[model samples]
Target: MNYEHVREVDPAVADALEGEVQRQNDTLAMIASENHVSEAVLEAQGSALTNKYAEGYPGERYYAGCEYADEVEELAIERAKELWGAEHVNVQPHSGTQANQGVYYAMLEPGDKILSLDLNHGGHLSHGHPANFTGQLYEVEQYEVDAETGYIDYDDLRDHAEAFEPDIIVSGYSAYPREVDFEAIQAAADAVDAYHLADIAHITGLVAAGVHANPVGTADFVTGSTHKTIRAGRGGIIMCDEAYADDIDPAVFPGGQGGPLMHNIAGKAVGFKEALEPQFEAYAEQTIENAKALGDQLQERGFSLVSGGTDNHLVLVDLRESHPDTTGKDAEEALEDVGVVLNANTVPGETRSPFNPSGIRAGTPALTTRGFDEGACREVADIIADVIDDYDDADVKAEAAERVQNLTDAHPLYE
Candidate 1:
């Protein structure tokens, strides 16, 4: 990871790359949507495939010298099919957002209604946030989690679906802690003759490992990021039945993007192969267990976790109830000072602004990748709780930073 070859041509860029590697090695990455990929994945992502231009699917590319590109892309698509059990798979979309765009472009016309979860309630910006293209192109209706229980109100979602008569219903989430009921969401979509697009961007690995309930068969379309939880390189994927394959392939390539990022697709193939091994199941299981331990420790320290605790890999802690004076940004900065890197997220019933919300979301996917167990994650949670308890205290921050260093040393990521 030294980038010595890059140093000769561009010392500044090489320095930044080396600095980033060192930063990851030193800090705790608790961000729910992030994970560390294997060196194999890293190498594949930095391959010469980046220079290739394979404009079409395997066996039907527009480019002449696409033999290796076709091979890598085919491997990725096949592995993804095996990982998620979909009839058809597209490994071309540039990102999870683009994956969602591919579905919308294929199945939806402009001004068609979109029913999705509200952004403040753990839903993604691609799932109909006003700033995104989906919100701009379609008439959007939102469903929310129960304010008291912190779970999706499935019945309410059904009611909203019936009322809105949306053309598509979006499920899966970004910061949510509980497992989504994709079947229930599918039922809601079916009741209104709507399409179901489950964006399992955060739980792709969990589902592939059978740690989380899969949405592939139930939803009409399934989309996800290959990076989060999956430990693949940065890319997005789409899966659907054979009937929709024609529409999806074109929608992703010529419609939403031009040439695919073949290097990232190579990384996806390598990571997906790694995930197929038995150890990946253990990793996914430990990820959920670590989240539970982290949430339990946080609660024991008097922090209020949304939904009481987590069933998945993330825990959303509302700082308003635990530390009323501290904003999520304040806690985020303090935790960063102590080497725990997570995000300040908006809770279900948000009272503060989106930029500096009232909640902090943490997860175990990256820590689990670093071979952390429940005990290790509990210790990390204690450090986090200490930071929140004494966010302004320099002595506390110093002590917490020392403890985080100890944990990072024990885990030894990318070493």
Candidate 2:
């Protein structure tokens, strides 16, 4: 992965690029939204298509010399349809937030009501955080997970929907660690004659592999990030039935963005093709198994996990109850010092601020990609427990760092 030409032109940027490669190879990536893409995906994303400007959908571009761009975009759309079984797919939203924006721009009017889960309860900013455009433009209301069980309060959601009469009811999550009941949310949306937008941004690969319940057929609009569990390059996708296809296409292109990132679309096509293979299903299943193992070990170490455990690729640990003195940021910094990478996250019924929350989130997609299994993940959990138990102890961090090096050595990446 030497950036020979890049070094000749821009040595500083090349150094940073190589440093990132080394960083990924040396550290554990437990960030829930991150994954290591295949070399094929990497190659496609770095291809010459990045220079092209394909302003419209396949075969209907606004510019000439778009034959190859059209081919890549069409392949991405077709492969996405096959992977997710959607009647229509838009692969040009740039990111999951943009994908959500497409749905809002297409169907929602200014000041329209939006009912979604609370961010501290596992919802995304695109759903309706005050800092995001969705919150500023729409009349937003939020629902919560059960504080006791750490699961979605579907009955409460339904009750809220009936009262709020939102234009759209959003399902799916970012930090929650359980299987979502899409049907229940759909019913809530139906009861109020509102649209359902299920943003499966975190579990796109699981849904594609049938490990998680798919919302494509249940929700009116389904959106996801291509990179999370899908092992695609960084991009967003929107899927829908034929009824809203026309609206979504323009909403993503002319309405939201100028020209599509055709290189990323090519990467998506390649990654989707890779995901269609039988091995990807096993990978998805193993990702869940690894997360369960990681969470169980954390629990046995006297840590508290949201929803008790995970049904997907990530686990959410609430440090407030388990380690009263420690914050998520404290644990996150200590873990990173030991080469274990994750993030500080907000748990349901959060008491602390979002920046320094009470919970830590971890996932196994990147670990599983590096060929880590349940036992390896459990060992990683033990290291995490040690760090969190004694974050200020240099000796403890040193020992954990040695173990992390051994783990990374055993599962080399980008070789």
Candidate 3:
């Protein structure tokens, strides 16, 4: 993985790149939105196709010398269609957010009503956070999870939709730990004559692997990131019925994004191919098992998990109950000092600011990708409990770091 030519051209950038690889090799990555892509995907992303300007879909490019680019894009589209079982798939959105934007632009008008989950309650900014352009452009209203159960309140969502009469209703989440009921949300959208855009950005691979509920047939529009659970490429995808293909393709291309990143599309093709392999199914199944194990281990340590436990790849720990004095930021920094990486998150009924929220979110996809199993995740949880129990204790952090090093050594990445 040495960037020899990069060093010859730019030593500083090369050092940063090498350091990042070493960092991934050394640390545990529990961040829910992140994963380690395969070397094949990496190679494809770094290929010479990055130089091409493929401004349109596969055979309809605006430029010449695009035959190879057309081949790669076509492969990516077909593989994605196979992976997700969509009538139409657009593989060119730069990110998951842009994919959502494509759906919005395709069907929504300015100031149209949008119904989505609340961000502090496991929603995404692209769904309609005030700081995002979605909120600024649309008339947005939010639904919440059941504060007691920490699950989406579908009945309440219906009530909100009925009252709001939104143009689009969004399902799927970022921090919630349970499997979503896409049909229930679809019903809600249908009752109100609203389009449903299910953003399975975080659980794209889980859905494709058939471990989680798929929204393709249920929802009018489906969007996901290629890199998160899919481990494909660092890009976004949009899926819809053939009825909306014309609207979506133009929305993604001439409306939101310009020329596509053909190299990343090549990476997506390679990754989608890898995901089609039998081993990738095992990997996907194991990822959920690891998350369940991690959550159970955390619970036995007296930690409070949002939604009680996980049915997917991540767990959300409510710090307000178990560690009343410790903010999520406190636990986050302390754990990072010990080489266990995760993020501070807001839990349902959050009382703290979003920046220093009252919860910590952790996932097992990256660890599972590094060959970690249930036992390894339990050990990691024990170390996390140790650090959070005594974050200020330097001796505790030192011992935790030692254990982390041992675990990382046992399960190496990028080699």
Off by over 4 Å in 1: none
lDDT per prediction? 0.94, 0.95, 0.94
**In candidate 1, what are the lDDT values of residues 222-245, reduced to their tens digit?**
999999999997989999999999
Worst 10 residues of 3 by lDDT: 54-63
Q: After superposition, how far is residue 113 of candidate 2 from its true place, in Å?
A: 0.4
* 109-132: candidate 3 lDDT, tens digit per residue: 999999998999999999999899
Q: How far does residue 84 in candidate 1 sit from its true spot (Å)?
A: 0.7
Over 4 Å off in model 2, which ranges?
none
Candidate 3 segments whose C-alpha is farther than 4 A from its true place:
none
Error in Å for residue 278 of model 3: 0.5
lDDT of 3 at 384: 94
Tell me the alpha-carbon RMSD of every candidate. Answer: 0.6, 0.6, 0.6
In angstroms, the error of model 3 at 219 is 0.4
Model 1 weakest lDDT span, ten residues long: 319-328
